[model samples]
Target: MENNLKMKDMILTYIIIGIIALLGNWAGYHVSPIKALPGMLIIVLITIVGWGIKKILPINLPAVIYISLIALLITTKIFPGSEWIIKETGNVNFLALATPILAYAGLSFGKDLHEFKKLGWRIVVISFVVYTGTFVISTIMAELSFRFTGKF
Candidate 1:
């Protein structure tokens, strides 16, 4: 709990981040007035699902991992009106979604300066490699799918 933050502070931080991300998304992506509403709803629902699953299952899963699962379940063809949802939510650049999360992650990491120093350069190297690989792999996959669909 060394790095513990007040609950209200955390909530406020997320709200501020969310608003910034919302504005960024709005400016970069054209959308109807109601598009942001669904994005918010989806984000909240996915978070709820993740928390609920974690609580009930007594698992050590993080919300983000479960949220991705929930998102995948929702995006399938079996989900009614998923096509419309995909169109709207797809417009929301997830890069915007990531900005605050990554910022928070960095701050959290910074909290344990002593532990971080103990880890030395190994963690830094690993993080760099992991992030680089993730970016490269995602780009390749995106390009492949786009090219296959003639959307590239």
Candidate 2:
């Protein structure tokens, strides 16, 4: 019963995330081209707000919000003339690149290395499986789309 509940929760979480992602992607695609800077700013603002709210909110609201914000950011980057907008945005990439390092540093400083060692193999296996699965699924989807649409 516990495992079943866990599976159900996981499935529901993924479904919510998927819906948020789809909506965010659609919004970004339509809005980013017209208002690149404003769109990026909105996304950054949303992410910051979500992070702040995460501190006080229960459940996975923060994760869903963060994912949607990140999707918007990526979409903004893909917009035409985004290079100039990014340049004007002033070192967003530097902050972006530093985030993961900062997170790793915080994790390393907060957690004992010995504890991580016990789960290292499990982490490695999960990472491998996820990466391979993503690659396979994306490749298959790309091929199918190209085959059906006659375009790459």
Candidate 3:
């Protein structure tokens, strides 16, 4: 079936990404690939399960929502074996995972430039305003939090 093929492709893609992330982790952060393998496997499993959930659920929702929820649930104190999950996943450097993802995002942005150009000037102006507003708001919130926590 087409769905099976899609799942197979997804699994293969996740494994490749995981391997690249592990290598990045080793090269950039000095974490051995052997040490990070468990964490990477767990992450891949979580992603696959999230995608599976998205397919099974009738409601239209992004796979990220399911992925985040699953991650949050498993890592929370109430979940059984939460500590072990946290400990293993902590081996993976966040930046290691982010590098490939950010690279992909950059490529996607480049690919979508034609579509992006089709949008009018007004949309561009609105996007800039929204981006600036979000950045300002986030900065203010971070400053306030740091002040409250006496971190700065």
Candidate 4:
């Protein structure tokens, strides 16, 4: 019963996010909402499927893992109808979707300020270390890729 309620809430939330992304796509990218709706709906359907898969599977894993897997598989050349899916989804500007998603992430962080405060300075130090490591690794990878491809 609880799971069903959570599913409903999640679906509603996805729909709301899709609507907001559509608005953002129209306003920021000059794409008509009507034109983008199909792609938005396809994306939302994929997300719902991913969420459902997470719920059905017994293993403990993040929904994002499932969502990303689903998206990746459907868009790959090996997948049937991949071209159509890719073409339809291309109408939606990714940045438009990212803006609202990032805004919500920021809001979530703000809501967790108390929990964040309890971590004290350790979180800050860890954050810096993690960020620096990520930056260094990313730079190295980018340089290697460029050298290998003879693009630098």
Candidate 5:
């Protein structure tokens, strides 16, 4: 069972997915694929580290938490060469990265129409409320940030 669980398919799937995501991002930015390497490497490396941490800890800490922490450390003074890497990938729009992911989500959603329909209009209402709240909060935060920087 353990051997089956650790099959190459799991790792290969991630590698393929990561490469596709990186390629899509590069295409969107019209940059050479080499330029996207650092960001792709960072993401893959961080994901492995996060998965390891998630496995070891007693608490049910998710992989995203660990990845976010690593990303935070890199953006700070802790990780050398992080500034250059961040700057290099800064122009890569996140929406481009999210496109494939969102597409996958839509496909997955379609696989279970019964389950989806069971949620009814509540899902629509909740989604609307959440998006509205997010927009309001983000706009407020941006305004505050600009005001602090004297750019508002």
Candidate 6:
């Protein structure tokens, strides 16, 4: 019963996330004619969805949503067209948006920083390896894709 409940909660969380993404895409498509409006709408819709899900759902989500909202506001209001924001905001946005979910994960996983200390070196080594591997693979793939399609 506990496992089933956990599975159900996981499914619900994914559904809500999907809804948020769809709404963002919809807002992006509809608001494209106006500069910044689509992005703004995407951010607004995501925040609303995040808040609504938290209110309605029984599961504890991560703090990414709150962080995402903050990042979005910063991007749209302060750094609207900065090259740094343009190039890196998407990645940062995911981290920010995922804050709530991450928080939940942290709580579910024990919420004690000291617990992670035991695995410190192993965790760091694995994370570094994964990050570097992903970066290299993605870069190579992106370059190849651009070369093949002449679009980038």
Tell me how many clashing residue pairs each candidate has: 0, 0, 0, 0, 0, 13
Q: Which candidate has the top score in lDDT?
A: 3
Which regions of candidate 1 deviate over 4 angstroms? 1-16, 27-34, 108-110, 117-152
Report the C-alpha lDDT of model 3 over 85-112, residue by residue, as the tens digit: 9999999999999999999998888788
Worst 10 residues of 4 by lDDT: 1-10
Give me the runs in candidate 3 sitting further than 4 Å from their true place: 1-5, 115-122, 138-152
- TM-score for each of the candidates: 0.58, 0.37, 0.80, 0.81, 0.69, 0.33
User: What digit string (tens of lDDT, one per residue) describes model 6 on residues 1-152?
Assistant: 32233445655665565445444434543322234334434554455555555556677665366547655655574665644455432322344335556656877875566677777687879989999999999999999999999886
lDDT of 1 at 63: 54
**Number of clashing residue pairs, candidate 4:** 0
Clashing pairs in 2: none
Clashing pairs in 5: none
**What TM-score number comes out for model 4?**
0.81
* Candidate with more favorable, higher TM-score: 5 or 6: 5
Instruction: Say which candidate scores most in TM-score.
Output: 4
Candidate 5, residues 83-151, lDDT tens digits: the string is: 876875564556666887887899898688887778869887998999999999999999999999999
**What is the C-alpha lDDT profile of model 1 across 20-60, one tens digit per residue?**
77776766665443567667556655656665665567666
lDDT value, candidate 4, whole model: 0.91
lDDT of each candidate versus the true structure = 0.71, 0.53, 0.93, 0.91, 0.73, 0.55
How does candidate 1 fare on TM-score?
0.58
Query: Candidate 3 has what TM-score?
Result: 0.80
**lDDT leaderboard ranking:** 3, 4, 5, 1, 6, 2
Stretches of candidate 6 off by over 4 Å are 1-42, 49-112
lDDT of 4 by residue, 1-152 (tens): 42454888888998999999999999999999999988899999999998889889998788889899999999999999999899889989999999998998987887878877788787889999999999999999999999999997
